[model samples]
Structure formats: structure tokens, C-alpha cells
Target: MRSLEIHGVDDLRVVERAQPEPGPGEVQIAVEWGGICGSDLAYWRHGVSGTATMRHPFVLGHEVSGRVSALGPGVDGFAVGLPVTVHPARTSGPLPERLAGRDNLHPDLTYLGSAARDPHTDGGFAERITVRAEQVVPLPDGLDTRRAVLAEPLGVAIHAVHRAGDVTGAHVLVSGCGPVGLLTILAVRAAGAARVSAVDLSPLARERALALGADVALDAAEQLGQDVTVAFEASGAPASLEAILRVVARAAVVVQAGNLPPAPVSVALGPIVSKEIDYRGTYRFVSEIEEAVELLARSELAEGVISHELDLADAGAAFTTAATDPHSSKVVLRLE
Candidate 1:
């Protein structure tokens, strides 16, 4: 089997590795498609994402879709060749009593493709890889592996919206129209937001934002009036965060879904205090992949986000386009 691994900053390689078989309570998947995320680009370009620095070579993907090729002992109800996507996360240990249903906030957690822990958790970019059966999610009707590659990121978008509380009939602004921000537009639109608007420094992102059902797409540097009732900061840009605070109406809810740098950056603070904005921070999804899968199966919202599909052998070109091409969003590698 072959996998895409990152050795260090600007060092992404496609190398062959041994094929993995399913273990007890696990399943083996023949990977079909995988999406390159902003974090993946971060790890490649800067050797870091948040505080997780790339200290060792590891497979670099989590937004993946594939078909079950083998099922290990004790795994039932799934047949060979069943299409699936993975949840990409597992509790590092038993959740504490206080965090029972809120497993996303567990004190200890491991996410695929992350280097937060030493002996970093390997991801699902290989041609065939084995994982716990519970991590596999069957594809819903009307969705296939290519489009299903978006399941994970869309789940993040949905969870971010979930953190925003009630958006029904409210005017919402999504700052930074990257793949996640575009998907956030879809999530908010589906959640009954009356009018969705987006802001981004990239013209490509703004175009994607409008294509994903946002009512208007504005340049990030433009002056924004305080009419939005809700706002989501998905750009991960510190400057955008400062601007978002100045634009949203007083008492509006703000959800920060983008991962900011670990180092401190200057941000204006007066509006947050004077306006009493409910600035909430959201991490990864807590089982919202199920809903994201359902949404993908029913609508074509995700299809527009996938702008390129390159073969796994072309991982270099894939990562390059994903990192440097502002016109491209959700660059997927065809693993099969």
C-alpha cells in the first residue's frame, strides 16, 4: 500500500508501506478519496498546526472515504465493499463523569493525522488501512466516496453552527470563506438563517461563499455595518477576528471555528466587552458526522466545495495546489 507522509516543512512524499489488516473489533478499508485540509497545509508549509508540530513522519489525512475490504473478528453488520467514512477521533481513555455526552471535550483525546501527542496518531491517507470498526461510518444514500470526502469538515462546520445557538431568521456573517467557511454557509443556510453573508480576502473564497448559498460575499477589508445578528469566524486569521468583532450587532453570538496560532497575537478587545458578544470557541465535532453525511446525501451543497481531485501518486501536486492555489477548495486525492 502507498501513503502520503510529511517529513517536515515543505517535505511531503508518497511512499509505499505494508498493507494493514483488520484486528479484532476493527475493519480494513481500501481508501478511495481523501480531502486535504487547511491543517494539512499548515503542517506541510509551517511544520505546525496550532501547537502540534511535526516531529515525525506520519500519514497526513483524516477527511477520507473508502470501502470496507475486510472485517476483523467481532465486527458484524458490515459487508465487504461497503462504502464508508471515518469519524477520525477516539477518546484517549474513558471519559470523566462530568463529560459523559460531551466527549468532544474529553480531557484526553486522539485525532487522526494530529501530532499533538508523541508517537502521533497516524491518519488515513494510505491505500489500505485498518481502524476500529466504531470509527467507520457507512455512507448514506445519494452520497458516494468522492463527495463523502467532505463528511469530516462539514461536521466541523455543523458543530460550529451548533455552538452559535439559534440562527433561525437571523442575519449571519461568516468571515473567511475557506472550505470550512463555505461549508459553514451551507450549515447556517440549512439551519434556517434568513440571510447569509460572507467575507474573505480571497476572491476565490468569496465566489465559493456565494455559490454555497450565501446571500452576499464581501471583501474582508471592506467596512461592515452592524446588522448581522450572528457571526462565525472560520478564516483562522487574527485580523479577521478583530474585524468580525467590529461588525456584528451588540449581544450577537460569535462562534470561532478556525484554529488560531498558539502564539499570542494582538486583537482589539473593546467591542467584545462593550457589546456583550457571546464569543464561543468550538473544537471538533461530537458525532455530527452522522448529520453531515445525511445532509450530503440529500443536497448538492458539498459538491461545489470540491474543486479538484488529483491522484494519490500526485500527492506533491495535490499539496502544492492545496497550499498555494487560492482558487482551489477541498483538493481531494484519489487514493484508489
Candidate 2:
């Protein structure tokens, strides 16, 4: 089997590795496609994502879809050759919250392809990999693996909209038109927002945002004159947070959907205090992965979302395109 590993900043290599076998309650998947996420780009460019610095060489993919090649003992309700997408998170130990279906809240949760753990957990940027059967969700019939690979980041957008509560008939603003941001636009529109608008520094991203159903797309530099009832900050930049506060109506809801830096960020406090904006933070989803798959199954959301598809052997170039290409949305690596 071939694997893509990140040794350090700007150090990515494709190496051969022993094929993994499924363990009890696990399944081995022949990886079909995998999307390169922003976090993956961060790790490739700087050997870190937020504060999670790499402690060892790490695999660099989480948004993945594949077909089951083999199944281990004790796994049921799944068959070999079944197409599926995976939930990348796993709990380190049994926790009350995790057992109660709030696994994302578990303090010791490990997300694949992340360096948050000392010995980083390997990810799905490979020819084949094994994962717990419980983490795999079967793709709906006729759902292409290319679009199914988006379930991971689409789940993030779904979870953010879930945090926003009722968006029906409300004006919504999505600040930042990255993959997650563009998907957030689709999610918000599907949630029945009356008007959906987006902001991004990249014109290409803005254009894609509009194509994804945003009523209007604006550059981050432009002044936002209309006040929105709900705002989503999908860009981790501090400036995006500040901009949302300025454009949100009084008593509006603001969901911080992006992963911010570990350092404290200073922003104006008057609006939050006087306007009484409901500010919330959302983490990885619990059950929204299913919703993401369902949503993608119904719409053309995946049309422009995938910008490039490269072979697994070109993992380095794939990461470079994802990191530096302003027009690229989701860069997928085909393994099979």
C-alpha cells in the first residue's frame, strides 16, 4: 500500500507501507477519493494546524470516501464493496458525554490526520486503510464517491447551521468563501434563509459562493451595508470576526464556525455588549454527517466544489494546489 506522510514543514513524501488488515469491529477500505482540507494545508505548509504541532510524521487527509474491501469479525450491517464515508473522530476513552451521543464533546477525542495527540493518528491519504465499522456510514445509492468525500467538511457546515438554531426566512451572512464557507452557504440556503450572502478575499471563491446559492458574494474589503439576522464566521482570521460583529443586526445570532488560532484575539466589545448578539462556538458534529450526505445527495452543491482531482502519487502537488490555488475549492486525491 502507498501512503502520503508529512514529515515536517514543506516535507511531504509518498511511501510504501504494509497493507492494514481489519481488526474486530473494524473494516478495511479501498480508499477511492480524499479531499485536502485547510487543516491539511496548514500542516503541510507549517507542520502544524492551529496549536497542534506535529510530533511525528503524520498522514494528511480526513475528508474521505471509499469502498469496503474487507470486514473484520463482529461487524454487521455492512458488506464488502459497499461505498461509504467515515467520521474521522474517535474517543480516547469512554466518557459519559460520548456514550450519551455527544462524542464531539469528549475531552480526549482524537481526529484522524491531526497532531493534537502525541503520537499522531494516521489518516486516509492512502491506498487502503482500516477504520472502526461504527465510524463508517454507507453512501446512498448513486452518490458518487467524488461528492461523497465532501461529507466531512459539509458536516462541519451542517453542524454550524445547527448551532445557529432557526435560520428560516432570516438574512444570513457567511464570512469567508472557502470550501467550508461555500458549503455553509448551501447549508444556510437549505435551512430556508431568506437571503444568503458571502464574503471572501478571493474573487474565485466569491464566484463559487454565488454559484452555490448565495444571493450575493462580496470581497472582504467591501463594506457590508445590510444588517443580517444571522452571521457565520467561517474564516479563522480575526478580521472576519470583527466584520461579522459590525454587520449583524442587534440581537442577531453569530456562529463562529472556523478554527481560530490558539492565541487570544482582541476585538471590539461594544457591539457584543450593547447589541446583545448571541455568540456561539461550534465544534465537530455528532450526527450531522448523515444530514450532510443527504443534503449533497439532493442538490448540485458538489458541481463547483471540487476543483481538482489528482492521483495519490501526486499528493505533494495536490497539497500545493490546494494551498496556493486561490480558485481551488476542494482538491481531491484519487487512490483507486
Maximum-lDDT candidate: 1
Worst 10 residues of 2 by lDDT: 218-227
Which pairs clash in the backbone of model 2? none
lDDT of 1 by residue, 144-191 (tens): 889999999999999999999989999999998888998999999999
lDDT of 2 by residue, 8-55 (tens): 999999999999999999999999999999889989887778878998
Estimate the TM-score of every prediction: 0.97, 0.96
RMSD to true structure for each model, in Å: 1.3, 1.7
Off-target runs (Cα >4 Å) in candidate 2 are 97-101, 220-226
Clashes of 2: 0
